[model samples]
Target: MDSDWRMWSRRDLLAEGMGRRGIQHAVEDGWLVRARRDRYLASTAPAELIRAVRVGGRLTCLALLRLLDVFVLTGGGLHVHMPPNASRMRSPSDRATPLAGRGSREVVLHWVPLLRSLGADDPRVHLVDALAHAVCCQPARHAVATLDNALHRGLVGEPEIAEVFAALPSKYRIVRALLDRRAESGTESLMRLMVRAAGATYDLQVVIDGVGRVDLLVDGWLVIECDSEEFHSSWHQQLKDRRRDLALAQRGYVTWRVTAAQIMYQPEEVAAGLRGLLAARRGGR
Candidate 1:
């Protein structure tokens, strides 16, 4: 009858005198349902976490990031963080379908030995640890985008970021170097990373004479505007964008816009476009 009874292991319930028959009655009465092998949850409990625990792991990486309501480029997996060398077949007989999708859904196992240090009572990874693991696992720009959002939401602070960097190995710290709280979305973060990687100079969130504040100003002339779908959806917003482009163009600033899809899904195309624009500028064309 307790609200905390949302989830209970069979052994724990038996120890509490629920017994096999009582448990069966609870299941039959629609008060409790089996989540996985020995685990049961109230009918109303959130199904988000069931698959991760069923696989003998805690939610981490992209899955945890999404659950925290942070912006992510593209991730639709059941990412589970397990102890190193842990068997995939913890309870092979009882496999719960991962919650994300049918064919595209798969349990991504991240083997981290450090998980053993956490208490056995909880399977949820701490936010700092999860972020650190995410940085190590994700692509450089995606990882920085996660960090930026975390900082933006005050879900993490400078001290927390410092701790994450300290815990990471030297090589993995490159991801941290890309972290910037100024980035408002994954699209902007990816654009900056791509520009920097291509050896081009850029200033982020730069305010020019015409455009109030563009996402990036590249090589003192090219204005890069990064748009996420949600912001650019309305006609009013499109009109404002066109006006901003016209205003910037009058000031001799060429506006080059990149959408979230282009930044995330078409990196080569984005790079090619940037290359052409830069070449044109250099050639005075």
Candidate 2:
């Protein structure tokens, strides 16, 4: 096998005789990609890491939310869960923090000592990771999305959610409540929060006269759609959305569509633009 691909299947390398210098050489030679100081990936790591760094390393929180297909606004830095004792072993570059868990660095690591009590099969790990990151990052919508995704993926159940809620810091009660609400996807939830923040009053999943169930409605005058590129990037879907917009417009309902990028990165701009448009409509301008 290629040296770059050696880390995945080599249990022996993870054992004795493995030193930092050997790992560093492997990284320098492109034989391995360093995910953390002691942890290496023999293959290309998840592209989300690069994206996360670009967005200020906030991708882990949002990525985990996305993995759960929950609705959330992406926010700052990769939040990692690391065991308290593991901090001494990590390099400064790892950017790890102490949390309640004992996890090896696969992605971001948060060191929390409490993770030891949970059963190995429990999905609370993912929930705690997402929630802790969300609380730290202030991506309340994204936190909700992660929780929704966890529920949808069967990675977490109702009881698990309760456990997570109980474990959360007292300040994160708002995030916990947001997570309690059912959401279809992280993108949608983020958009909803954005719209609400913009002072747009509308019913979610409201049925219009002919537009079917729109994702969001604004004062019975506008329809807002949140598009996730992963699912809506296809030409057919784009065409369909355009058709739907045109049909909605013909029926006297204004349509505004927001993409995941806009919702995640430029939320204020999106909200401001929508608010301006709504104001103009109200003024009959």
Candidate 3:
């Protein structure tokens, strides 16, 4: 029952008064499943964490951050952290077999050690380590977004942020200048980068006299709101958003709505679109 409520070591079960026979009986009774040698999982264990254990690595970096509800710009596969010399990897899908080849792309693996290990039964990388690994996993802007997301959610403060940078090489320190706690969402962090790359200036989380607070204001006229499908999909929410847009428009502010999907799945397209509109604005047409 202890140890993050899911993964457990054999010693953990033994400490909980489960002897050898008792452990076997629990497995047979479907109360527990053997995750690996000396490792076990409760029936209620999360499939993702189980996958990390089965793959012979800890869930980490983007994979773990996304699981913790932090901002991750890209998504594709399960991310894992293992020692540089670890072996006997199994397929994440079926725990029964070993991986067929050198490595599977489906399981993104990080052999580099960013931080000290956590408890044996803790199937996740430490949050600070995960953040450092994420810095290595993503491009510059994306990495900054992830850091901002962590800060905005109060998951880590400036000291922890300093620890993350300390784990990285010196060149990465440049990204520290871009980290801003005010970014309300990962999307806003990304949108801010896109706006800058478009050669436009913006004020983040700015408020106008007539309109309420906005995600970002570009050149004092354009307001960009990073919308997510889950929150902005409702009829009522859409009406509210439309009204907000109109209100800004009436006050000589142009509002651009960017969806989460469009930003993550279509970055180049979004950047191109932003450039065109920003150019039009600069031309005063």
**Candidate that scores best on lDDT:** 3
The C-alpha stretches of model 2 lying farther than 4 A from their native spots are 1-80, 92-109, 115-130, 152-154, 180-182
Model 1: per-residue Cα lDDT over 109-221, one tens digit each: 66665532454435457788888878876777788888998987788899999988887889877877778888777678888888887788998898887569999999898
Residue lDDT tens for model 2, 52-152: 22222223344555444554554423444434443433322342533224222334544444422433212123545565555555556666666665665
lDDT for residue 221 in candidate 1, whole number 0-100: 87
Report how far off residue 26 is in candidate 3 (Å). 1.9
Candidate 3 segments exceeding 4 Å error: 1-6, 94-96
> Which window of 10 residues has the lowest lDDT sum in candidate 2?
50-59
| lDDT (Cα atoms) of all candidates against the true structure | 0.75, 0.58, 0.85
For candidate 2, what is the TM-score?
0.62
User: 2 or 3: which has the higher TM-score?
Assistant: 3
TM-score of 1: 0.80
**How many residue pairs clash in all the candidates, one count each?**
0, 26, 0
Q: Which candidate is the best by TM-score?
A: 3
Query: Which of the two, 1 or 2, has more TM-score?
Result: 1
- Deviation in Å, model 2, residue 46 alpha carbon: 7.6
